[model samples]
Target chain A: MSTPVTSNPAQEESTVDHSKIKVSPEEMEAYDQSGRKPVLLGFFIAVVWLLIGTVLGDLSSFKFDRPDLLTEQAYLTFGRIRPAHLNVMVYGWASTAMFSVSLWLMPRLCRTPLRWGNLAVIGILVWTVGLGVGIALLLAGHGDGLEWLELDRQWADPLLVIGAAMVGASVWKTLAARNVHHLYVSIWYVAASYPWFLIIFLAGNMPFYKGVESAAVNWFYAHNALGLWLTTINLGLIYYLLPKIIGRPIYSYWLSLVGFWGLALFYALNGMHHLIGGPLPSWMIATSITASIMMIVPVVAVGINQHMTVVGRFGAMRYSPALTLAVIAAMSYTAVSLQGILTALVSVNRITHFTHWTIAHSHLGLYMFVTLSLFGGMYYILPRVLKKEWPSRRLVRAHILLVGGGMVLYIVALGIGGVLQGLSLLAPGEGFEASVSSAKPWLLLRSVSAVIISAGHLVFAYHAYLLAFTSRNSLTRHPPFYELKPVLVKKRVP
Target chain B: MTRILVLIMGAMATVIFALVILVILPNSMLSDLKAPPQLKQPGQQELLGRQLYISNGCIYCHTQQVRDPVFTTDIHKGLGNRPSVPADYVYDAPHLLGTMRTGPDLFNVGTRLPDRNWHLLHLYQPRALVPWSIMPGFPFLFEHKPTAEAGDKVLDIPKPYAPSEGVVIISKEAEALVAYLISLQHNYPAPDSDALEEVQP
Candidate 1:
């Protein structure tokens, strides 16, 4: 390992001081050039999708309070818009953002400039086109009716699969040509996610399954899309960022090993827990519940590893927006994973299964955990690649507070309302309409929260646009400005 | 662990194991499932209605699966006579076993309210039937005629929901949708092997 370790605090500090280590300017420049085009393209596309998806999500949430608001057009109806919003956010925004992060991180970790950069660029463009066309088809009333698989199987899905493959090829090729002897933990996660995603995506979209089997496959794909794909990449990013920003090695390398494998083995079975109390076999649900509970092993391992690493270095977040977002995202991962385990239990699933509570839980995972991590990744990568600091610190602070505060309100409102709605549904005396009435106020609050989140996205989009396009440079370069001037290096060749 | 190939193989093996156990095994075990005698294949119009249901994304709000009566209140709520079974959905291609219940379970909605007129009116304007309903009215599925023609199925929309200048007539799409909704009955007794046993308290 290149980094030194010691038990003595003073000696350790001196040994691990970042400035003492030499880095070749040419190598760093090569890494930046290799990733600049694909990463920037992916980020730009992701921001646009984020804006569009947020609007669609806001409109869908509002429909709960006023169903007649946009009923004039079939395309504008709640059903179409809701799925459109979900797809746009998941595929267009989150996946693209993640791809960009992976593209940037892989080269840096491998100690090699990225290979096939042009192919990665092509992949991003193709994925963007596929998503755009798929959403249009969905709005035009040609959806596949499966939740996450709403994109047309023949027309849109093929392009996505091919596009993702192109990007994956680039990532793998970069990994194969690594200069480093020991692969980082992040490499395992980011690399494994591509194949895992491909397997589940193909398996879920298969047309053969019928009846309860289809539901089984649907959720297996959907939940894994979160666990193996989204969860894996974000966790990998956090593992890298948390330690890097704090200028320390991870707390325990063994804990990371347990966490990574445990996630892969157990998360796939957790999907069946979503169908608890439904028509599926009891044994299937039982296995899933067992697996869901078993997720605690990985969740806690990851939790402790990240927490201990940053315990004394909490002040580092003040200097780095990326660290701030990563810390929060790591916390959300623990919270959402624990909540998921509880919800998987039969008793809890009985209440939250079909209610808005599930929606709240999903947002906590997707928005709080995954999206925030992506934002942090972007904040860190954008400055380095663009050779500029964020245009305005005020905009960064505003983006954080708005999104963070909005999500807290969103989860709380819908969480309580969903529980009450579940109770009402279970009460023999209460009519079904009572359940709807009970959730109405919370649904309205959810709409308000959506608007807040949309505002945050708008702010983030404008800031990103300025950082990428405009030449405005901030006088005060952020800390870790060591990259801009490599004068501290005592010239060393690898 | 440092080798890329080892990492890839290990990851792939774990997911394949999951796929086998969760998907392949369950599918093989349920492969012998036979549709109950009463669960007939949907006719031409009902199939058309099913298409309409899928296209309009009705499955987003409405679930087709009815939960266990003993564990939940699905039976007491009149969603189904018994818990739905694997055999109950043999005809479903991409199963409409929805996740959310923003509206209500529609697995046995056909058996609950079989009245064709009520369904037509409900589709044209949900508030006409249930004042507190948040379901969007499918006005595009109905026509606004100045006067009802002979043999036309006119929706009995109440005031405030009905158009001020014209009569509301159910179009073929609405009729097909209603037909599909009304055909959701699965009250047939599931085979003992496939049936979900209620847990005695």
Candidate 2:
């Protein structure tokens, strides 16, 4: 395992297979240097927001069990803090983390140094300030009524829209100046996310759309923000990291085409499923449900392709932090997508809609799938950019266990509590208070789970701090292939 | 060039399509929608209450729309007298048809539960009425004075939730919010609400 792999410059012509197997040292160094500053800044800011969101989430959950806990103060009330928690997690943590990875990956995949690097850094600064201001306003009781778009549009939207555009423009410039001929699948995914994000952010925050229609637009933007922006970028990162780590190409290149196109076509229509049994026309909901069911094609295609790539190399997960989180995230991708499909069905939607069951489903998608995937990608990317190694493998393992275990406890309790609540609401003679009472035990459990999740965030934030600022010489220079079998496996050809 | 086009266009079209279905088409279809027969514009107090509701993020927990009985028993649960319709919300700007039903639907809450005192008490301390409610009491919206003044309306809060040494008085904001809640009554017949067919004998 201590044996160093050699890179012979002339081997690009001497061996056809070897050319594809290794990236040139010069290219690797160039890719590593590109977007280094913005990525680090993003990572730092994302960790800070993550910790804040976790604390807010814990306090909100605690308030559910004991309403009087913070009733003395208006700003700390559950109504304000709950939305504040969501905004912090979604916009502050998820968006910034995705942006950081996308900034690095886009330039690398294009074989070009990031253009307008200064603009990207400034954009991040603006965005971070805007998000903080928006959150503060929300806490101070200036929030809009929309679920995900709670920040006041007049005050907050311009900063976010402009800041995101500046950051995204740099990535597009990098894409336009690509040194490579063939576009990788990951490049396609990353290229698409920035534009999609801008369009939706503007459309959702527009002042004209109102009444019942506003609700429709709200879900349209909210769901697509998750689908096109967060989910797409994470998928792109996985596509890049999985093969890059496991020393192979994607299992089926053709299958990726099917998955990408399927998602692009179907995911938008599926947003209306959130409005099932709503005041909208029946045809609208029916169309959304159909689109939702069609999501299975993409989900299955992507799932099969990703799983088959790592079929025999499950051992790689033991060694690679990136691979471990990516695999768990990949599994969760399938689970959440299928779960979403079922939940969109009319019968299931009847029972689950407006219940905590949907909350569990969303956490499955957001926490389990998107956040875990980003964690994996960051692990792989941060070391390369910083020219250092992780300070502790124990911290990485601890993060995985804590986050994974907390989500399981959280989702399960919410799922059962939601079902019971839904049933109690539906029963002819059951009182509303009875349903409320039944969810208390689960709500208390959720608070405990939040504490566990917060611990995981602290561990990750500290680990990142160590990797970024501590002595570069103190950490290992080589990749920590802790569980690989020293050398490449011999192919057993018949 | 082709690759860039496909990538950009592929992403762009998703939002465009969503806008068509969710925004444009729905707006065009319901563009002529007016207030239902029994609908009236919210008065100054009710509008203030609506703003307070939005500011407080009540929409996070209490949805304002009740689904058809086929999909939910919200009507049977006494959340509303009938299914809510788009026209029922024509006068609303930034409609608050919330997603989660953590508490009961409040579309017809004002009609079904008419006691202003009950709402005031419930808002001040939810557990005073329902022992197991997880809803946080809005203590900030009420003041606990040593005694009620001439014009101050005293609350009849039950024991334990009430303060030991003071009378609970509802603030003006609480009063406006209650006025808005009562104004939410759409129990009147509407073309889309199925109000005529579903009338209780």
> Chain B TM-score of all predictions, in order?
0.90, 0.88
User: Candidate 2 has which clashing residue pairs, if any?
Assistant: none
Clashes of 2: 0
The TM-score that candidate 1 achieves is 0.94
What TM-score goes with each of the models?
Answer: 0.94, 0.93
- Cα lDDT of candidate 1 equals 0.87
List model 2 lDDT by residue over A1-494, tens digit each: 11123244443222122226345667776876878989888888988899999999999888888888988778988889999999999989999888899899987777779988889899888888889889999999997778899987878877888889988998899989976555678887888888888988888888887678888888888888888888899999998888888887778766787888888888877888988887777777787899999999999999999998888988777678788889889899999999999999988888788888988888999999999998998899898888788887678878888888999999999999898888887778988887787777887888889889888989998888888878954568556546343222243222
Candidate 1 on A205-257: residue-level lDDT in tens?
88899988888998899999999999999998998899888878788777888
What DockQ does every candidate get? 0.58, 0.52
Best by DockQ: 1
- Regions of candidate 1 where Cα sits further than 4 Å from its true position: A1-22, A474-476, A479-494, B145-152, B193-201
For model 2, how does the per-residue alpha-carbon lDDT over B1-201 read when each residue is reduced to its tens digit? 226877787677766877787678877776677677788899999999998898888987898988878868887888777788777888788889988888888998888888888888888988888777778889888888999999998888777778989898889999999999988898887565443223211
TM-score of predicted chain A against the true chain A, for each candidate:
0.93, 0.93
- Runs of candidate 2 exceeding 4 Å displacement: A1-22, A478-494, B146-150, B192-201
Looking at the true structure's interface, with contacts defined as alpha carbon pairs within 8 Å between chains A and B, what fraction does model 1 recover?
0.72
